[model samples]
Target: MTGMVTQARPPRRDDGSSVQIGALVPLTRPGWIEAGHHLLAGLELAASDVNDAGGIGGRPLELVVRDTAADPQKAAAAVDELARLGVAALAGEYHSVVARAAATRADALGLPFLCSSSVLDALTDQPTDWVARLSPPQSRGWRIYADFLLGAGHSRIAVAAQPSVYWAAGTRILRDYVAPRGGTVIELDMSALTPAAVCDELAAHRATALLLLVGHPEPAVPIVTAVRRDQRLAETMIGAPAGQPEFAEWAALLGDDGAAVPFLRYLPERLTPLGEQVETALRERLAAAPSFVAYEGYDTVTVLADVLRSHGTDRARIAASWPSVAVEGTRGRIQFSRTPDISVWQWAGPPVQVVDRDPAEAEPGRFRVLHTG
Candidate 1:
């Protein structure tokens, strides 16, 4: 059921015709399945909303999901499959590696792809006119993290990055941003290290802040908890740009230690009416707190539906129309940049905010915005 593409029965569409939007997600992957499910929840809700609004050109929008399982080769193959299946546009995929691979294939096939959650800077590096992204690339997003740390007067920092291209790219960006600002960055390869080892390394460096760029919150919970227990690094400012705030059990796993750890997300301080509506609907349907990927997935589909509505299902026309089209999504307005350096053809720094969970909140994932960039 998780990987299966589900659509509302007929009568939701006019003439029983549907324009399928292809979604590439991690449905069966160990660390990514939960995120994939949340993304699907958002997509389903958005599809329903579009259908209720009479659909795109009277044809209901349908999502055809293909599981990438966080594998690059599978992601590329899925893009080909989605194109062969005659999807109007493409979206989804949580991992940057998968997104990058899929985007290339989607672009090669002349299909329009809107990346929902990948943050690798190079995902938009190519001159592929057919691809665009809703998530801010790591290059732009890491600046927000760097600025936050420098602004908070913490110059001595340590980075614990997982062995993924997503985290590696972020580590590189953070180092580039910090060194020029008279700050020092100590790097730690967290692939095979234990929580105690990670703590010892940070403590030895007298690190005032720790930047966790891990792939999941599982490692982060123990590492952060253990580091906080050390007297030397007890007050170290812990921050993660790795979508930790999106996990429903983020707080439950991290406990009180997880409090005040800032993370990068596409959401803002205040939710618009539409954002609130989506939040409420997702809560009821999923019976769990929705993650940031859910919001991104919802907005990506909304934008895709709108684009199809205005320009029909012609991929070339839709890709061409993206520049001038201003999409109002869950996270304020969505606008793609034509600039070459700034994650080319991406929603130019789409209102990313650093938020943290308040330990007192009943729902742990209900993070409050601590900083905005």
Candidate 2:
């Protein structure tokens, strides 16, 4: 969590004998640091496991990590530097916008990038074999979330959204998906309103559900507190489709207030044999339950290691091998193909679940599976 570079073991041969995969992660402020920590934990853990299982053709798989700090320009620059450093492939990014920038640069450089946790539908403006993704796209996940909202009898929905490409795309996805089903999405620009003003708007609009299309711990935590304490909106549901409640920081900040806020998670009803083992290792590594992002990190390495073994460390071969990947990941059998509207070779079926912290359970990480898609 603290180091920029992480290696599974000392080099078996000379320092230059190992295969290096460039990792792009956000490890500082303004980024989701907690999510970044878990992501790095999974990536490093899998790298260690790959070494343990006789690394790619007996060469140690090393990770040369660079912190993006959630900045797209910074991430693009990191991709350029990593390419110059001779990394055969690139991996690991949480923010969708940052991943988009990194993916574009990686494609231009002809370096294969296996994106770990960015869910934006358009990872690139045009499809290319250079980029592939583990996480489901925003349109698929957010549309499932909208269906969960409509199924729960929440017809009138309000979104307190900040201005960003990711937030705007989520808002548009919810609006387009929900409008046809008699559900209305009312947008409240968070830049122009305080937490108290958001509550007032919710009450004025008579919204039954309020979605936080904003960042964590600032407006999101305060807005949840305001809406929870307000007597007028006691029955209103608070939702974060971006998976804010999956992290311990949200529960630590909001406590029971954070419970019951349904969010999107890409996990199955039960972990596969590989998944269960990785979960235990990740919990020990992270000192808490691993979020879905952690599993994404593990699977990204899992796929990349297999590719490196099969195709050597050549960048062109790695990019060409994405469609033929058939590794069994922690969650399920992982495979990549062209998904409709998604510009990357995507894992078409990473399990999507709408889960919330169960207030009934007095524990922090206890989540109730409300609905699955």
Candidate 3:
């Protein structure tokens, strides 16, 4: 089915009612199907747990799932459909393009929307009272990456930026952070350049580290492979901040070449007690390790449940109560940040870590924390 509405559990209360939360996920999109499944897995698990624990004032949580298809128009239409169905609040969207459009629709409809994984800094740039996010925005994530590179003593860096609003925001943040510190950032737009051409530019720059803000592995795999094969650039520290969630997929495509490459992720290398619990459940359910995206999805539902529990299931009340939310999430304590430099409704300064890929570990990414902030 393209979309489905599933209740968390059988209704147990005398009223025989359930509170509906809308989820706008990219279920059928070309590059996003796997990510969509993992995210839905997390949200389903959270809903099940909440319903099992007596639900929100005895009303079981029902998630109305819609396929956004990673398109802005589809995203808006999904929100409109959810609004017509009368959901109390809305959440779940991986693509920033879709989230931005969906959030606008949700705001206009007076429904509270929580972004699951979209990272465009502009998503929450303007003061919007209806939307909030559980993931760190692109600007904050890249700034953290810059701090990690500097801490590791890499001053000269080469940037392989893909042309997308998400990567552009990250590139701007990295440039602003590095250049002011007397560090050099050589940017190569990977949009039009061939893999061989990108390698030539990297050689010319001769930087100690390569920061790839590209969201996917199409260009990253070929570029990183070419650079690693080059004897001259073998020592360069290559990092792909945007491709962390897709690490396993990229690693399979890159083979041993993917080993030792660093990437950024919100989930720390070390899982908290709660984190371990969630991982165990996810692994048991999915028959595979959960991605950071899954953790964010779970946290998103839990946060909504929190607001609904205390402030009631009123849409306006949930939006009004978001700023004051402080729930213990799978990674750690989750809270929205209002800093001017970040997405206004974003989870401010979520701890990110630079992790290296190790082939021997059980996890596909085999992520080992190299640095944390």
**Which candidate achieves the best lDDT against the true structure?**
2
Return whichever of 2 and 3 wins on lDDT.
2
Model 2, range 220-325, lDDT digits (tens) per residue?
Answer: 9999999999999999999999999999999999988999999999999999999999999999999999999999999999999999999999899899998899
A best-first ranking of the candidates according to their lDDT comes to: 2, 1, 3
Reference-based TM-score of each model: 0.92, 0.98, 0.91
Which model, 1 or 2, shows the larger lDDT? 2
* Model 2 ranges with Cα > 4 A deviation: 1-3, 14-16, 361-364
Superior by TM-score: candidate 1 or candidate 3: 1
**Using alpha carbons, what is the TM-score of model 1?**
0.92
Provide the lowest-lDDT 10-residue window in model 3: 243-252
Which model, 1 or 2, shows the larger TM-score? 2
Cα lDDT, model 1, residue 197: 92
- Please give the CA lDDT of all the candidate structures: 0.80, 0.93, 0.80
Ranking by TM-score: 2, 1, 3
Per-residue alpha-carbon lDDT of model 1 for 1-373, expressed as tens digits?
3346767432354367788999888887553788888887888889888888877777777888888888899888888878888988998888888888888888778999988988887874567789888888788778897888888888988888877777777877888898999999888888767889988888788888888877565677788778878787767888877767557666667777787787787777766678888999888978987778898899989999889998989889989877876877776887777755644487875777777786565765456776788
Model 1 Cα shift for residue 158 (angstroms): 0.7
